[model samples]
Target: MSDTELRNDGRLEDEHQLDADDRLRPEFVDAVLDAVENGDTEEAHRLVEPLHPADIADLFELTPDERRAPLAAAVADLLDGDVFAEMNDYVREQLIDALDARQVADIASELDTDDAVAIIEDMDAEDQREVLRAMEPDDRAAIEEALSYPEESAGRLMQRELIAVPEHWTIGDTIDYLRGHEELTTDFWEVFVVDPAHKPVGTCALSWILRTPRSISMADVMQREQTLIPVDMDQEEVALRFQKYALISAAVVDGSGRLVGMITVDDVVHIIQEEAGEDALLLSGAGEGDINEPVVDSYKARVRWLIANLFTALLASFIISMFETTIERMVALATLMPIVAGVGGNAGTQTLAVTVRALATNQLTQSNTARAIGREIRVALLNGVTVAVVIGVGVSIVFGNPMLGGVIAAAMMTNILVAGLAGVLVPVTLDRFNADPAVASSVFVTMTTDSIGFLAFLGLATASGLVG
Candidate 1:
């Protein structure tokens, strides 16, 4: 007989695995839902049982909202901690809302501290309290203490589950202790060594411990240099520290310098993704931008930006109004003016994106800001000259007016140069003032490029008597 297990549906276990797309196939999802709809909970369980926890989570997400609770009921046994951890925030919240406090507590209990806190943190205040009350005392305390920390802080992100030992213990003692401790966390790459006062002094990777002589003291074998993350540090900064040090996991220290928890690279990965996506959405003034976000919430987040855009656009319109007579004299002026402003706006946006990313990644800093600005200016000058030549020749041929061409060429170059400067300067200035550059940079940069482009082009046209 083949070693691989065959399912009741006549498919091998290997065939039941998730595909590369990280999504369940349509037919498979339909089959599961059909089973649930027909009230065949056992068949629904059988179909979903072979999928990975993450795939199961995706299945819940794929299921429609009203049907989600029914599906959850059908596959209640599969709705464990791993599935909950991998489920989307919106979907998990929906499911959690339907469960009783005890059920939620049971699910939270099965997860690591970080994942458990993630589940509980989204609950309504009273629901959170009730769920906390339903949890085992120890689990409740851990969740409550995590809750005490500010959201998005390291304290809230770190897991209380870790392996820690005294520095004075020998390799033999450490090995014996590890083998004997039934309650110790199963997942860890390194063992932290703490002083008598419970302050982390060093760390010893599992390989090092296993390779070392049994008589070697933990103090002697452990690497003394360690990155200790402050519990109160922001998650972004925490991710930076992990990235900078290439850490697998770092010890989380409290105000008293005691080792309280550990932040693993796995958790850092999530934070990195969240922060990167957040800055990107903020740049476009799109709040969260998660499809799971409520309609009203999405509207509230986007409408303000549209309103702000209306006002900024009016500012550009006002600039055009100032040159109304010049435009009316030469219709060509109106046709060509948009080219200068449009190209300049695109150039500005490109620079703004780069500057914002550099700032976020710490690639751009005070010491390098001047050199960075100079570099951008040089690039802008080259870009400006190139675009100016193309637009200049095109307009000269199209309008059959060499003077008008010269006016636009000069205007394009001037506007692009200003756009580049405004792009870098706007974000840098916002960062300097402790404001989030990504949140407001585009609006200001667009305003600068548009206003300057119109002013430069029309002013030159009027001055040269081409428009008159």
Candidate 2:
């Protein structure tokens, strides 16, 4: 095969090969880099021509910002709506800034509502308004309405463009309308049947339209029962509904049950990814945690949590300070104190991780809250005994003081049990008060484990007269 005839997939070059998921192969990426270095724009375009828009987006993401301009210019027209839609937010914003408002609006018009909103939302308010003004009046209005909703809500996430027909329309009429209409959404799985007031009354799958007789009324063929999402609903809740129902797509309705938009599986797929990532980041006290974030912004986001942690650490120190007399009197207490606190802290962190995940996924609710707490308590007891026996015997042999060993063992058992309880209870309590469990729970758990560990070890030492 000629070099052009050798498809990236190792297939003989053909138009059909063009439709394949031709990712930017390592060689192609290398070729682009080499061409850019050599200032061979034609060679760069030739190398990029075979890749899909998503692949192009990936290239942009992988390339450094310095190389992006040359690479983007080399394949100028190829950066169409699909490629723009798939680009990372940071990259897309940068690229959009390079283009004028009209150019950005032109590209935005080709994308679906959710994708369009995503592209423009990151732009400055003035740029956003300019782009909106450049759009068709109807499209501009729909986007403006979406922009008005709180960010990350269902309204902002849904696509305003969708296929809907009056319930009274016959199957033939619906089919004809679909085939003839230029304004309908390019991709849809179900055609919503709406009432005179624009409320969604039913949904008819594409298969039903193709199979049913032309004369059948949509009302007769449409499934009357349908899942409708409220515009103001949380995106996470929308994802849960999609998961629960195994939905391909669902209608989005306003407060009065009027059909306003539609959310497809494509949108939900992004939501699931975003929500999962957000939860993981929040658990780590990282805010949004985007790599594109400025260093100062990142430091500012994390410092607040670190500051809160410093205070909690001080509280733990105060508990240890109260027992300074005990530590000074018995130097061995210093050697053994960390063992109690470290193990308890680790155990508490494990429980806290599980609890936060459960709460985020809605697996832990009021009905089973008590049962979960009881289960943790029992597990803690079992774990405490197992660990205490091993550590106690080891300490007894090493310190040559059975009393000291017994004291450490008792403290370990007490602290670990408290750890388990605190881990489960702290997050739940925070959630109950409408606070994010992931954000605030770690600080509380740290405080609990440290304070308890110190108190248990020191009090045991003082009461047993081990210090005296």
Instruction: Work out how many backbone clashes candidate 1 has.
Output: 0
lDDT (0 to 1) per candidate: 0.91, 0.87
Per-candidate TM equals 0.95, 0.90
lDDT of 1 by residue, 296-385 (tens): 999999999889888989999999999999988888888788889999999999999999999988889999999999999999999999
Error in Å for residue 369 of model 1: 2.3
Number of the top lDDT candidate:
1
Candidate 1 ranges beyond 4 A from true positions: 1-23
- Please give the range of 10 consecutive residues that has the lowest summed lDDT in model 1: 1-10
